[model samples]
Target: MNNKEPWLAVNLSMLFPGFGQLYSGKALKGYILITIEAALIVSTVALWVQGSLGGFLTGFGGSILLVWNLFDAHSSSRSGNEDSFETSRKAGKDAWLGIFLTRILPGLGHFYMGQAVRGCAVLVLYIAMNYALVLLSGSVAGAILGLAASIAYLAAACCLLYITEKNPLRYPLLHIKYFIAGMSIVTIITFSGALLVRTYIIQAYTLPTGSMEDTLLTGDHFIMEKLSYNNVDSTDPGRGIGHGDIIVFTPPGTPVQEHVKRCIAVPGDIVSIKNGEVFLNGAKLEEPYAKGETTYSGIEAGRIEGTVPQGKIVVLGDNRRNSLDSRGFGYVPVENVTGRVILLYWNTRQILKMDFSRIGKVR
Candidate 1:
């Protein structure tokens, strides 16, 4: 026994991790770690091949296992030495303080175990990466990074468990500290992405009806720029729209309903609907797409002639007879103009019915 180098046992344990378990006659545990570590390595490589290298499974789980292995090795050192491994019965005031701070801050646990630079690096990297992920992809990516940091924390607790054999519950406040630290990462990430960073795309509306047919058809999904209507420029609706521009507007009576039509008459222009034809500025508007020579004029039956009011646009659908448009509901207020219909996405029933070759590009 005098010839036995117990420090060799410690060094070997520190080198390979779980070797300390082998030294303690727990060969089963040592083999388990080895098996798990190898399996994770293989799986990580396979996932990288499948193009999920940056995914949560690879980034979070791989990071955790790496830190866990390091901590396991560190704890295994000085395992059997009486002087070096002797644990205090009172749990020691300073030792408890170190553990407490480590619990409060990620990677601080490793620092408390005398791995200073590594601890600080881990803490800084974890925070910076988490912040970046939130900024780019919102909370989804940030949460994964947090879970990885937590695995490191678990490794530290497991090390302490190996050394002290004390109940972690006895350190209730410290346990809360670690729990909060891990949760703090996720909370910051979620809040920053949701409120501060603003990584989501703006909502755009699609034309769901054919009231604006020939310009914007039913089932045509067009992109409306939210930024265009954000600032109301009442003086010159031309700040956003000009002659010949197809505009989308919410009619005066219903705030939520949207109507798309071509701007034939701007503010102060006299507009008249006569014999089913639109007479704008004293000239019969020649719209090639207006299908009928005589409009049913039924939809706009009660409509009367008037000059387009200031800050109002006279918008009409190309389908003169069937549309519920400016003639039916009156002029559209300039403030209600959403944006010009930019693109036509997909016509729902047009798989083999491919009359329109236009698919993606804005009209």
Candidate 2:
């Protein structure tokens, strides 16, 4: 505490990964921490490219670095056996502010208290939990599980902030302006990111009609993959639209709502219907997903024949006889295709809509 400048080391380390140790004359330790931090940054980017779950690694690595630097800064700033820092020793940081900040954003208080790595880790876990909650949106078991996971995350985050702030090297986190700015920035980022992800990457929807029946029930909820047909990103690895794929698209005349149906015939293909059986390219199509023998006879009992026009495709409901689909509405334009239905996701029992099950995948 004899004025070796603990604040300088702490602040520098806070700014980067290992600046505190470097300033405190711990060159080797500083280099190691900085190297690890850099590696983690690279790893995080790679993980994001890999898949959704892998994206969590970046935050995980950053959090670890925060804790290491906090400890390093504290130990290095001490005058050691030389008695130089004896008089410069200071009091611990405010605990109440720690609680308030952590509660607001889970790990932000840790970041403010110089535990950057730990804070980042908490942020990652919190985000992952939120993703899980979104996926498990409509079931009672899912709600309970999501709520428990969130509470646990909150508790762990607050505890980390509390511990970091209580340390001997911690400083006051009571600046109103900084707190307000931090909270505002975080809220904006989180909300905007969520919106982008939901709109462009994936969106969830509940089936309002049993038109899809055997393939997708009335109470089923599914996630739509939005990246490919939108032509938003060329590097997107998802496949192009193919026959038999389930798609969520707008009917030719409907602009206010969307229709979900199976892609029965693509452009240039001839589609013909007879006796509840679909024929493609002059061959009777095999529809393993449809409940061919179970549907009622409301379907217009007639023979129809047509070739799908260029830039347009023909779609049909699984319950062929009972659905008002391409047979009634004409061709669906490719431009109207918004997203592909990739997963079944969730559903409830037909008799008792309250009973739920994770249907997982759609036909």
Candidate 3:
């Protein structure tokens, strides 16, 4: 078989991460590329869980590998010095199958390409990362692992599939019609499932402003539980919004933007800020999360009525110096409350200031 198409190798590598190198018969290089990328990906995620700023810096290695793979694959394919691997392609494997298979399971595509040991190791690592995340921090950590796991699979698939064209298969490449139909189904299912989950169960929100700084920095993203707070009336119990709860809400006048803050006082509760100290119901509220100090001057500074107004909740920012909350906008109406923030979830900042340690629970 005249399977020496440099462009095919390039295209395959372009589709996956290390396929081009494998196609060029550089099996060791291909394996190294995939392994490094997978390791860096999981490492960055671990850094994130540990809340280190180094995650972003470490994650940059994957990009370097991407460029290196493309360049090396082209060079190897053009030269006659390629080391050939005699592995046969398993039946019915191609780029598309590799993509979805790797995307969903992280290493199944490698198994399909006759790299059983490599495939098993990657699969185990990916699954273990997610499982450990779930055990350490529940589903949100698992979700983060899901997002980060792409790097692992992309690199593995590319390396494995680069050699796929050489082997006998039921269908080495997906026909155009099947590819289109398969992609369409995947798109529809993913979109619909995500939409439904976000609408009824949970949704992610990013803090655009630094109002909730230190605790929730600007650009920090969080997961809000909607089942408990969505369209909830004022007098609701059980899933009730209470003091110390972080909530997403639209201040009375701003219908276009949303703000998140800690509920300092609920209906019929008193709140006062004295020189950076918050007094709740006559006792100074305990707040270790408060950034430095609070001031007494805004609409929130003075003595409130003996109780918070009915159907309203008093909210304050953890970073009181910068936050515009119930102090500035008055009490947040029950209807304006969007969702209760259940998790710190995700945080993204500029490369210089990026921190992942802040990703976790809010309470």
Best by TM-score: 2
RMSD of candidates 1 onward, in order: 17.1, 10.5, 13.6
Candidate 1 residues 1-363, lDDT tens each? 111123233333433445545655557867786676667656754443232423336546756764575445434533443552234322443333344455557667657667677577767866876667546442455656555545555455334323433444333445445434544554455445434312221224566677666656677765543444444465565455666566667889998666777777777878777776777789987777664553535555535377777778777676666677776787777778766554454666663487556554443
| Model 3 per-residue lDDT tens digits across residues 1-363 | 334445445555654466667867888888887788778877865554344556557767777777677767767766763234212222245554554456557777777667778778988998787677556442455555644554454465455546566543322444233433443454455446665666566677778888777777787777776666655564563237877888888889999577889888887777776666878899999988788687745454453435677777888888887878776777778778877776665664543467545556565
lDDT of 2 at 118: 79
> Which residue pairs clash within candidate 3?
18-158, 19-158, 51-356, 51-357, 89-167, 269-308, 276-294
Per lDDT, what order, best first?
3, 2, 1
Clashes of each: 0, 9, 7
Over 4 Å off, model 3:
1-180, 231-239, 274-276, 298-304, 349-356
Q: Residues 189-243, candidate 2: write the lDDT tens digits.
A: 5446545665676677788898888778887877777765775444322225688
lDDT of each: 0.55, 0.65, 0.65
Model 2: lDDT of residue 161: 36
User: Per-prediction TM-score, please?
Assistant: 0.43, 0.53, 0.51
